[model samples]
Target chain A: MNLPPLVQTFVLHFGEMGSRWGINRTVGQIYALLYLSKEPLNAEDIVERIGVSRSNVSMGLKELQAWNLVRLQHKPGDRRDYFATPDDIWQIVRTLVEERKKREIDPTMTLLREVLMQEPASAEERHAQERMREMHDLFELLTGWYADVQRLDTERLVQLLTLGAKVQKILEMKDRLFLVPGSKKSRRDDAKDK
Target chain B: MNLPPLVQTFVLHFGEMGSRWGINRTVGQIYALLYLSKEPLNAEDIVERIGVSRSNVSMGLKELQAWNLVRLQHKPGDRRDYFATPDDIWQIVRTLVEERKKREIDPTMTLLREVLMQEPASAEERHAQERMREMHDLFELLTGWYADVQRLDTERLVQLLTLGAKVQKILEMKDRLFLVPGSKKSRRDDAKDK
Candidate 1:
């Protein structure tokens, strides 16, 4: 089956962007095709639409499944496996964030922790450990926040996103109303009260 | 100068992860070295420490500077250039986010917008366009939120991040106390009120 010109353009663009995001071009193209497809498509359909080998489509599908970006389905009468992206865009975004955190952030955090545990043998080693500590702390803060936000319902998450810069106003209000002047302990106590 | 084993372990690990983050191994290693170094390093020092060619170190430094990941400094009496990562980790994080957005996210967003402008030629094309629209909307929401948060002072940002799951409670409070019941429009209006 031939893809429409518009689909073709998007597929090509995504294919090019895939390398920059660590996936191969074929996997990106296959995901794009699956995402835009109105119905679940088999490997053969993907190969025909994407102009790749059957094996390549199979491999790409496998990788997408591993990333939790695509879902496998079976037709009522057909025995061949079919695939499609989640219908909800927010779910797709959530999957992408979670998978990336697992693959990219989690391992680095582990390495930083392990490196930080070792005794610094020199001033240079001490500085490197300090840098690693900073990185580890940043990653912990980010990933922990993401994990918390990930639990929110789509409606609530959208509310937060749409607020955008208004959140800064909210943060200022939080600081002014919650914290006692000149005491970190009061801030901690206020956070607990909330 | 030879790097300590502890620093070497981190440099090597970062080098491996670098390819996944869209940079080559040498560039990742060079950045890691500069980030962990106690003082500014010159090209010769980097080349010797990273065990890469002088030309490769020069090119990697060029790339790092382009990403705003490394700073170029000159010794008062010496002609040779020196490089170092920013002392503040938040600054580095901000640069990484902005640069990646510029390179990876912005172009895809522009392409999605342009593609959305074109009239769909068929039912399949229409479905593809819908998917693109969803993706574009998600990207807009995310990048806009990021830009807003980027403007925040580091202390405030840290407070927000450390709040983690507690943010959900805050959001719920905002919704109940601030927004009029049963209307998305009212919630948006309330945001504008502040």
Candidate 2:
């Protein structure tokens, strides 16, 4: 499948992005193809369209399926599986964010907790542990906040993204307004607190 | 040169994270050391400290220097270069954001622009171009907005992150308050049309 120049650029960029994001080049390229293609594409079509090996396409598809980034479709009278991205960009964004948080944030938080539990053998150890504590607390608040933010409607999410600098102003004032800004804030904060 | 168990965990996690964030594992491990260490360490020290090869430490330090993530410190009596990370997490965050935007976001925007200028040869080509344009615009705005946000003081950044759901709610309302609902509006939208 010969790609149009525009999509070809997207494919190449996403491939590079995949490495940056810890995914492989082939996975990124396959995702780019799926994201751009208007129709549900079968494995052979992806292999043909993207000019990758059939096995590579198969593996990439499996990874995409694992990430919940693709929806499977089967044609009438056809046993081959086809895949396409959801129409909603927000859904795609949410999945990417959630999946990443699960892989990166949650595990790091767990490791942090274990490190914090270790007894300090020296002043340096104590200082290091203190820093770990700060990071762990921050990440916990951050992950919880993001999960809650993810629960917002797409429009609401976009609103937050577009807030530009206003969001900064609000965050700085939050502590002043509520003194103790723990997870147990108020019902309003809890409403969106996921 | 042995590391505390907790620090060892940090190193391994950062090594994994480095790959995810487009940095090499060794480089990430070196960075984790720099971040957690109480003093500036030389390249040889880092090699011994992390139990990695000298060449690997050299390469990792080179990459870290390129990212502007690590600062090289000079010791009066020592001939070797020493490195350390800023104590401020916010500074590191800003540096990473800026570097990633430069590497990934900026180049992709340029590619999108070039593709947009090409005349469409078919309806499919036209559709692909349209999608590219949307992606390009969204990314440009996002990076621009992020740059603006990055300029905010730490107090402001924390304020924004803490805004959480409220920020999301505000972003969702961009359509009603702004002209041209559900359409691509440039920064020029703020200015009246002739």
Candidate 3:
């Protein structure tokens, strides 16, 4: 499948971004193609469209599958595997956040636990350890809040995301109800704004 | 120099996360070291500390420098090039956002423009092109907002971040500001809330 110069450019750019984001360049480009595509794409179609090796496309699909960013589809009478993106961008964003938390945040929390058991040899070491503890606690609270948010219906999320800039004001007013521990206040200087 | 176990744990976890965030594992680990370390480190110290090849450290440092996440500091009477991270996490976050916008968003915008210029061969193709236009426009708005947010002082930015979830709410109401094209009220189900 020959791609228009414009679509090809996006594919290429995502490929480069892929490496920066943790996915390989090929995976990034592949995703870009999928995102822009109006229809579900099969692996072979992706292979031809992007001009990469079949095996590479296969590998890329597998990785995308692992990330939960790709949806598998089946068409009647079709033996080949097919994939599509969730229709909602908000859903995509939410999934991205959840997957990142799993792959990135949760593991870091586990590492922090291991560090907490170590012996501190000096006053400074103890102070450093305390800082580490604070960071760990904060992250734990953050991870919990993320999980809570994820469980909310999609409508609630869009309600939250659209909040955009005013989110600070509500927090300042204590918004009364949304004030969970980690959710309570920011450690940054803006906390003074409230 | 011996690292306390907590810092060491963070280093290892960040190294793992590097692959996920689009950075190399070693590069992530090196940055983790720099972030946690109180002193600037030379390439040799990084290589020795991380047990990576000196050349790899050099390459990673070069990339970090390009991202503006790492800085060079020369010690008195020391000929070696040493590097360190910004003391503020928000600074690091802001820099990351800026770099990602430049490297990822800017190029994608270029591609979207190219796609818009292409002549659609069929009505179906036209429909797909229309969707692409919407996606492109949304990205353009998002990138512009990021640029605006970047210009805000650290204190203001913190205020925005500290507002956390509420910021998302305000962003939802942004369309009320004017008769902007895509900025028009979203038909999304959650559009009416806060």
Q: Which candidate is the best by DockQ?
A: 1
Error of 3 at A41 (Å): 3.1
Tens digits of per-residue lDDT for model 2, A1-194: 47877678778888887877768989999988887777889999888878889999889989998999999999999999999988776678778878988887788888888888889888777877877787787786677678677778755455555656655444434434555655455444534422
lDDT of 3 by residue, B99-132 (tens): 8778867876787788789898776467557767
What is the lDDT, from 0 to 100, of the residue A48 in candidate 3? Answer: 88
> Once model 3 is optimally superposed onto the true structure by TM-score, how far is the C-alpha of residue A136 displaced, in angstroms?
3.6
Please identify model 2 stretches exceeding 4 Å from their true place.
Answer: A167-194, B168-194
The 0-to-1 C-alpha lDDT of every candidate, in the order given, reads: 0.87, 0.77, 0.72
* Candidate 3 wrong stretches, greater than 4 Å: A51-55, A123-194, B1-6, B53-55, B148-194
Q: Report the poorest 10 consecutive residues by lDDT, candidate 3 chain B.
A: B170-179
Docking class of predicted structure 1: medium
Flag the better candidate by lDDT, 1 or 2.
1
| Model 1 lDDT per residue over B1-194, tens place | 36898899889988999988989999999999999998999999998898989999989999998999999999999999999999999999999999999999999999999999999989989989999999999999999899899998887788777887687667666666676776886556445442
Find the 10 residues in a row with the least total lDDT in model 1 chain B.
Answer: B185-194
Model 1 chain A poorest 10 in a row by lDDT: A185-194
Q: State the TM-score for model 1.
A: 0.93
In model 3, what is the error at residue B24, expressed in angstroms? 2.7
Candidate 1 lDDT by residue in tens digits, A42-153: 9999888888899988888989999999998998999999899999999998998888888788888888988899999988898889889989989988988888889877
Q: After superposition, how far is residue A29 of candidate 2 from its true place, in Å?
A: 1.8
